[model samples]
Structure formats: C-alpha cells, structure tokens
Target: MGVQTNPCLVVLAAYSLILIQANITPVLAHVINQTESPATAAPQAPPPVAPVAPVRSAMQPLQATDLLTADKPCSHGLERQMPYFGMGAPGPSGSAGIPGLPGAGGAQGARGERGDRGEPGLSGFPGSKGDKGDIGAVGPQGLVGLEGLNGTKGVKGEPGRDYTPPSMSAFHVGQSSNLQVTSGSQIISFNAQYINIGDDMSQHTGVFTCRIPGLYYFTYTFRAYSHGSYGLNIDLLVNNVVKSQIYMTAMSKHLMQTQSTIVTLRVGDDVWLKANANTYINGDDEMNVFSGYLINAI
Candidate 1:
C-alpha cells in the first residue's frame, strides 16, 4: 500500500534510460536475473523522489526510443508517455585549438578619388633583355641660347655681273718751262708726263688729286706769245673753285687757248692749272695741255 508516483511519468522514464543503447549495465543485469528466477517474479517500482513540473520537450531528434509503458501501470503509478526523438550517433573527434590573437589595425583611409581608367590588362610575358650600360660623362657647356627671332627676310638678290669697269683713272700733262706768270697766282707746272694712270698725276705739282670718285674729264691747252700788250689767264682749279676758264687776249702774235671740262670729283678733290694777273704761258710741243679721265666711278 505505498506507490503514488507521477512526477511527469518520472521524467519520461529518466529520459528513456539515458538514450538507451542498451547498457545500463546490461539493462540492470537483466533485471537482476528476473528477480532471481522465482517464476519470473515482478515487484520492483521504486524511482520517483518527487520534484516535477518542468516538462518542455518537442525539441526532437536524438532518438533511440522507448519512453516507458512497460506491461501496464495506470491510475496513479502512471506509465503513459510516448513518441519522441530520432537521429543521433556521431561522436569522437576533438583536440586542436589555441590560436587566437591578431586583431587591431584599421584606420588609414581617405585619399581616393582618382579612379576610372581601367580595362586594359592582359598581355604579360616578355621580360628578358638587359645588358648595355656604360657611357656617361660629358656635360657642361650649354648656356648661350636666347637669340632666335629674326628670320624672315630673304629673297631679293641677283644683280651683280661679270664686269670690269674701273678703268684705272687717268691723266696727261705738259708744260716744260711755262714762259711767264709773275707770281700773283701760280701753280701751272706740268713738268711733262704723258699718261700717269693712277700714279694719279702730279708731275711736280700739277695736282690731280681725285683718286676715283665720279665723272671727270678735263682738258686745257694754252699757248700765248706776245710782243706788246698780252694776256693768257687760264684756270681750271677745282677745290679752289674755278672749274674752267681760259682767256687769250692778244695785241700782238701767236695765240691759242682751249678749255674743256666736266669735273665733279670727290675723294679729296683737288685739280689744278692756274695762272693769272701777269699771265703769259707759252710752251711747245703738245702745248701747255693738261688732261684727265675717269668718266664714271661714283
């Protein structure tokens, strides 16, 4: 008379005898050898200890069945809880840990705004060519540049011929013993020279100093013989300005006076032939002539 058990069916029969893989010491030694074989006796119900009200399963999957209801025990000794769990049986595999300590490095961002030029990458396999380097040491002579802005003025040249027109100036003179000119104005001495080409005429000062500088052509011829009242003033100075002159007044005899000129000399101009006041001039052969040349040479 003492068996009032019902602690939620004794915790579903002790969780189905701890997932029964059948070794609760061989199921309690076959229930103690069937109660000592006394005709298969049965009087063993002592496992309740009373502390229930905490049933929350339905979290299935760990099966191996049998949640109590053996033979039959109702009304108060309760034995009616069924259906549960299913897959379980996978254990043995542990040992390989201890490797954690590496986390702290994040704060270096903000220099990004130059992207969008990609899509050209697939051509790699060409690297094997290096051996040629030795020639460097020649520098220092470069600081003369700033004179380049004057090139646009060319194309107008062609007018110089094959010529020969200098004609070496000329001269001719005569006057060996100019008869008489009593020093009131003199220099009519042409000590006779025939053609002094660029030995620029000066037979003892009958001057002709125009070493080439333009048209010149002078001529003079004088011879005046007298017996009473006579005159023969001749002049052709050029630098003493009397470019050409001749006067042959005679009240007696021989008279000859010729004058020709076209002078325009420059280079230190100074031509000559002069006799005035008591002028007489009577010489022979080629008379008292003086001539000049160079007609064009400016």
Candidate 2:
C-alpha cells in the first residue's frame, strides 16, 4: 500500500524557515549543540551526507534512516529538507478597525420604473360674458301660409234714392224708322221705350242723365245696310266725350253690330248715342236699341 503523506509536516517546515530567516535560531542552536562538539574544544570537521531520493515515490518506502539524527545536511537543496512540524495554530481575529473616510461617488444608476397616475383637480370658476357682435344680414323670406276662413255676412243695404220696383235706375230705348237718315253728327233721338225704369231717360234729346253716383254699363246694337263705300260709322258719347264706336264696310248686305262700355258717373252726367256723317241704320223690326244700367254705387 502507498503511504498517506501528512499535510501538517508542510506547515511546520514553512514556519521553521520563516524563523530562521529572521535570525531567531536559539532553539536551532540548542538542537545543534546536542549533536556536535563544543566550539572551543577543537576545530572538528563534520561528516558528509549524500543526496537521497524522495520517499514519496511508489517504489520507495519511508524509513527512519532517511532522517539524519546527528546534523541537518545544510549543503543539500532546500527543497530536499524534511517537513518536521505544522504551522502554529491561527491567532484569534483582531478587534474591528477605526472607520475610514467615505469613498468617491460611483457612476449614476439606471432609470427607475414609471409612477402611477395622479387624481384630477377641481373645476375652475366661470368666465365673464363677452360683448355683443354686429347684427347679421336678413334671411330669405319664408313660405306662404294656409288661406284663412271666410268672414261673416254683412247687413243688408238700404235702397237707393233713384231706385224703383222692377229694377234700378236704367233704360232701354229703340228707334224703328226702317231708314233713319243723319242730317249731321247729331244725337239719335230714339222714340221706342222697351224699358225706362225710374224714367231716367229723355226720348226727345236722346240722352240719359244719371241720378246716382256709381259705375254704369252701357251697350247698344244697330241693324244697318251699307249704302256706298263710305262705310257706316257711329259713336256712343258720355258727357260729349266719345266712349265707344263702330265702323262697317260697304261690301255686305243688311247686318247688325254692337258696342258696349263701362264708366263711372255722378249725378247730372249725360250719356247718349250719335250717328256720324254719312251713316244709316236699319229698323230690323225695332231691334236697334241702346241700354244703360247702374252697377255699383259709391
């Protein structure tokens, strides 16, 4: 079996070497005196020791004879020296030292994580009112509204002063003279009375005088035959002013014509029919007539 080498022998050998270098060799001197002659006895030479191979080799066995009892071989290599003892046991740890000055500041650390959000703040006070602006342009007109309801009926009006029973102040007169010749531009004095309500007409003068202040409608018809190229022409006058007229050419036989007008008249206003120069009217069995009637009163 191989020998188990001891580790304590290595520590003891290192301790002995440290003491010898520091010149603390009193114990070493005593050990040498036990194996050598006194220094004053005589200058004696010591015996030599030959180098020996290490005993740790597998083939070699450790023996007591390898360690010399008398003298350590100083001429031998230090590595050849034998390990005799273990290092002294470690001393107790010393007391804590005084504190030192603070060290220099280190490099800046990494950024930290983000913090949580904060709560909302209270609402602020309301602001003051602003000044008024200029007026805007007018907008487009709106659509028309629906029609309104009919009004109430009015009271019945009183009869007019010149009005009589069958009709109002009105007249229808005719002339049946088969051929009435015109001496000049004169009034046609009609002689036949078909209707003369209120007697507001004059058969002699051929004029109707108004007795009411109102609008009146007048119409007349004449049956006639043209004699020559000077066609028949007639006039209906209101107060000496021509209000209506008609003309006929000589190219036809007996025929008929009509003319009508509306006018606003006051009391004493005259309305009449007159034949112009060179005009003839037929009787047509008394069908030639002139008429007038009040339509509205002021």
Give the top-scoring candidate (TM-score). 2
Q: What are the models' TM-scores? A: 0.24, 0.44
Task: Output the lDDT of residue 265, model 1.
Answer: 84
What TM-score should be assigned to candidate 1?
0.24
**217 Cα displacement, candidate 1 (Å):** 7.5
The digit string of per-residue lDDT tens for model 1 on 1-298 reads 9989776667667766764633345556656776788575665554334333233243432233434434444555333334434445666788888988998999999898998999999999999999999999999999999988989989999999999856578888788575676658887776778888888788788888887789888888887777455588777888898977887675477878788979678888888887887687766748777888988888
Which runs of model 1 end up more than 4 angstroms from their true locations? Answer: 1-27, 32-170, 174-183, 187-193, 196-214, 217-236, 239-271, 275-291
Model 2 is weakest, by summed lDDT over 10 consecutive residues, at 68-77
Candidate 2 pairs with clashing backbones: 12-85, 12-86
Per residue, candidate 2 scores C-alpha lDDT tens digits across 1-298 of 9987554455457656764653545545555765686655554444333233333433343344443222342333332344332345678999999999999999999999999988988888988988999999999999999999999999999886985644378888888775444457767888788888778899778899998789999998887775665456788888899999977766467778899999999889999888877677776536788888889876
Runs of candidate 2 with Cα error greater than 4 angstroms are 1-167, 179-183
